[model samples]
Target: MLARVRRNGGTAEEFIGRSGPGVQARVPVVTSEGANKVQDVRFVGLDGPGWLLRGTITGTGAVPGSTDAWSCGMRLVGR
Candidate 1:
């Protein structure tokens, strides 16, 4: 996954969140001109018997001031 991001000129950080069933990854985009930009994305996945369910949070919900991402992640894992 990280490799995929790098292939497109972006960087990713994978981390384990406190309550999710799987690891969460954040891909922050690097502006070629000068500024560092954060991508509003949180990918949460749950490994199942024969499949995996993945969820993504974007927009303001993926930023520091929102709980929508966490809530959605929990819902995905809980399923």
Candidate 2:
């Protein structure tokens, strides 16, 4: 599985982790844009068999930009 965060003119941080009964690992993320910051993400699995990922990100560069985006709902890896 792959996750990505994109910004208009600034950089983005990245973090990857595995959540399951027998899976525990931290993966590194690579960035393609210049001066883009990247970091590892941390997530916790809930008691109801669900994973929750939360983090904060800051944006830089000129404001007042417009863009369209699409997203998929969170899903459990294994059930």
Candidate 3:
């Protein structure tokens, strides 16, 4: 998954164990012919009895190894 992102001109960081078994990527936000904009995005997945959850996060909450309230809360829930 990380390779795929990089291959397409994006950067990714993977998180594991206590923080995540997920990926955070900074990908191009433009598809046009001009200068491309890059934005950070996070992808997280969780599986429980007969159900699965996948989340995509953006904005300020997408900081890598984030220590904010929302990021902390998510880590607790994921565990």
Candidate 4:
């Protein structure tokens, strides 16, 4: 999954949060004010019998060390 991002000219770093192993990256965003911003995002995948669950963390939840990220990750990965 992360390989696909790097192949497309983006950066993907591995991280272990409450969600366990996942990929993190900084993505460019255009805000409501029409200003450019670099936002932190995370992608996590869970696999189950012939199925996959993908979750994304964006905005405040994407900030490193933020409790929001931890909580969200827990909910996503713990299930």
Best by lDDT: 3
Q: Scored by Cα lDDT, where does model 3 land?
A: 0.75
- lDDT per residue for candidate 4 within 1-79, as digits (tens), equals 7777777556789987776778888766689999987778888777778988788878787766667746454654346
Best candidate according to TM-score: 3
Which sequence of candidate numbers ranks them by lDDT, best first? 3, 4, 1, 2
Q: Clashing residue pairs in candidate 4, if any?
A: none
> Candidate 4: where are CA atoms >4 Å away?
3-10, 69-79
RMSD per candidate (Å) reads: 4.8, 12.5, 3.2, 3.1
Candidate 1 lDDT by residue in tens digits, 1-79: 6677667665556656633643233466677897777675655677779987777766765554355644444744355
Clashes of 3: 0
- Supply candidate 2's per-residue lDDT for 20: 23
Error of 3 at 25 (Å): 0.9
What is model 1's C-alpha RMSD?
4.8
Rank candidates by TM-score, best first: 3, 4, 1, 2
The better candidate by TM-score, 2 or 3, is: 3
Model 3 segments more than 4 A misplaced: 17-19, 31-35, 75-79
Q: After TM-score superposition, what is the CA distance of residue 53 in candidate 3 from its true location, in Å?
A: 0.3
